[model samples]
Target: MEERLIMDLVPGLEGIPAAESAISYIDGDEGILEYRGIPIETLAVKSNFIEVAYLLIFGELPDRDEYERFKSDVTYHTRLKLKILRMMEWLPENGHPMHYLQAVTSAMGMYYPARDTLDEEVRYWSAVRLIAKLPTIVAASHRLKHGDEPIKPRNDLSFAANFYYMLFEREPLPLVERILDTMLTLHADHTMNASTFSSRVVGSTLADPYTIVSSAIGTLSGPLHGGANEEVVRMLAEIGTKENVRPYIEARLERKEKIMGIGHRVYKTRDPRGEVLKGFIEELIAHKDIDSGVFELSKEVELVVAERLTGKNLHPNVDFYSGIVFNGMGIPTDLFTPIFAMGRVAGWLAHWMEQLKTNRIYRPTQKYIGKRKEPYIPMEERKRATAR
Candidate 1:
C-alpha cells in the first residue's frame, strides 16, 4: 500500500516557514534584529535612512560613489508629477491618509510602466521612484486633507529632514532631524512582517512594484500592525494624568481588553526597536521643550504595565514609545502609520526583488472541514435557513 501523507494545519501559519529570505533577521527570544548581519542599534545610530534603505535593497552597504548615486537618484525623483497632485486634490478631505497613499501609489503604475519585472533597469528605476515618492505622497495627502497646498520636496534637504520640511514647511532642528532619520532607520524593515509578507506574496505573482507596495501599505494600515502607534498616542491621551496610569491599565486588564502597544506576538522581552526609541525619547525630553506630558505618561504606563504583566512576558513594544517621539516632534497622530509605511516600503521592495529571484506563486494548502458533495436540491425543495 502506498503511504498516506499526513499534514498538520497551523492557524495563521505561526512558526511556519513561508519563504527563504536574506533581507532581515530577528531572534525574538534574544530580542535582537539585524539587517544584512548588522545590528539594528548600530544602523539606527550610525547610518541615515537613505543609506540604510540602499543596504536593505541591495544586500550590502554601498561604496561612497554608489551611496552618492543612490541618494541622488532618490532625491531627484522625490516630486510628484503635477497630474498626480491634481488627482490627489479630489480625494476626500476626511479620508484616512493611508487610503490616499494606497490609491495614489497604485495609480503610479499607469504613469511609470514597469511591466518587465525581469529587466534590471526597469527594476532599478521602479525601486527609486517608489522609495523617493512615498514621503511626498504621505506629506501631500496630509496637507491636502487639511485644505492646504502640498509643499514640494526640497532637493537640498536630507531624506528625513525633507519629509519634515514638506509636512510643516520648515526645516527641523538638527536634533529633531537626526531623531526623525533614526526613527525611519529603526522602522525600515522587520523580517517577514505583515507588510513585507504582503509584498512578497504579491511580488510572487510578478506584479509591478507599485501594486506590490500599495498592497503592502493596505496591510500596514490595519490596527494590529502599523496603526498601533496611533492607538498608543490615543491611549496615552486617554490616561490623562500619570496617576491614572495604573487604574486605566488595571481596568483594561480586568475587562480583558488590550492595552495597545503593551505586548507583541514575537518578542518575549521588550522589543529592541522600543528600546532604541526609549533612548531617543530621553534625549528629546532633555533637549526639547515640546509637550513632555505625553512622554511622562508613556513612562508611567510602561511601568504600571511592567509591574502588572511582566510575569506574563508582556512588555512595551516599538509602538509604545514611537508615538511619544513623533508627538514630541509636533507630528500629527494620524501620520504615525503613514511614516511607518514610508520606512517599511524599502523592505517591501527588497523582499519583492528577492521574491522574483525564486518566484513561485504562493498557493498554501488548506484543510477543509466543510460538507463534501451533497445532492442538489430543487429551488422549491430547499427550505430557507431559520433566522437566528
Candidate 2:
C-alpha cells in the first residue's frame, strides 16, 4: 500500500496538484503558458480556435487530413436542436447570460440522449458535440433574449467567423474574425483552472459530458473568475476618460479595494495571454477607429497602475484589456463571460474525458472546523433551557 503523507492544511487548496494532465502547462513565475508544450503566443499567431481545440482535446496538433475531418465534424454538429432554440425564449430576459448558459448546457444532456457514459467513442463525440454546439446555444440565447431571430450555422466559415455570423448574421471583417479566433485559442485551456477543476470533480462521478461541463459553467460564472473581464469593462466605463483614470486609482487605493483586471491569483507577474490580447488590441487600433474612451482610458490606467504598484508584483491579467477588445468588437457586456464559456468548453470537455480515463471518484478529505457531534435535544426542553 502507498503511504499517504499527512500534509499541512492549505486553504482553498491553492498550489495543490489534484490530477495529472498533459493538456496545458503554466510557469506563473516566468509568466509563461503553453498548450501541449506549444507556447500560447505561437498558437495565438499560428493557430485558429479549432486547431487549438484539436491540440487541447487530442494531445497533438492535427495534420491536414485530420484537421479537415475534425472541422467537418464540428461544422456538421454546429446547429442546435429546434427544441433548444425554442427553450431559450422561455428564459427571463433579465436573467444573467451565465445562468442561461448553465441551464441550457445542462439541458443538452436531456436533448441529446447519450449512448454510453463510459464508452471512449461516445465521450469523444460528446466533446466534439459540445465544441460544435455551444456557440449556437450562446448565439441563439443572445438573439432570443433580445427578441431577435437566431442565424443558422455555416460550414464555409471558420469557427470564429461562424460564431460571429451566427450572432450578427453577417460575415465579420477578416481581422475581427482572426482576432476572435486567437482569443478563443488563448482561452481554450489553462492548467486546471476553477472551471476545469469543477469539470474533473463532476466527471469523477462518471457523469455525462454535458452534466460535467454544465457544472464547470456554473463554477466559471463567478465574478472572480470568468466574469472578471466584464467587470474590467465596467471599471473603464466608470473611469470615463484618461484624466479620471488617475483619480479613480487613487480613490480605490484609499479604500484598498480591488481594481478589476489589474491583478490575478495565479501569475505574480503578467499573464501571457494578456500580452497576446494586448498585441491584438494594437492591431485593432491601427486598423479601426474606437469611438469609446475605454480603450485609451485602459492604456492610461495601466500605465498609472503599473507605476503605483512597482514592487507589489501585480499586473493586468487576461481580463484587463480583453474587455476593451471585445467591447470594440460590439459584443454586449453580459455576453462576455458566456463567450468565455464558449471558448473554454473545449478545455472543460478535455478535462472531463481525461478524468473518466482514470475513473476514480474525487472524494477529498476535509478538515473539520465545525462543532463535532452536537447533541440534539427536544424542542420544548431547548426552549425551557433558553428561558431559564
Estimated TM-score for each candidate: 0.96, 0.95
Error of 2 at 357 (Å): 2.2
For candidate 2, list the clashing residue pairs, or say none.
none
Ten contiguous residues with the weakest lDDT in model 1: 284-293
lDDT, model 2: 0.86
1-388 per-residue lDDT for model 2 (tens digits): 9998856788878888999998899988989999889999999998888888888888889999999999899989998888887888889987888888899889999977664778777876788898999888888888888889989999899888999999999999898898888888888899878899999998888878889888999999987678888888888888987888899999998898888888777788779999998887767767654454556677898899988888999999998878888988888888888889888988887787777778799998877779888899988767653654
lDDT of 1 by residue, 50-132 (tens): 99999999999999999999999999999999999999999999999999999999999999999999999999999999999
Please tell me which predicted candidate would have the highest TM-score against the true structure.
Answer: 1
What does candidate 1 score in Cα RMSD to the true structure? 2.0
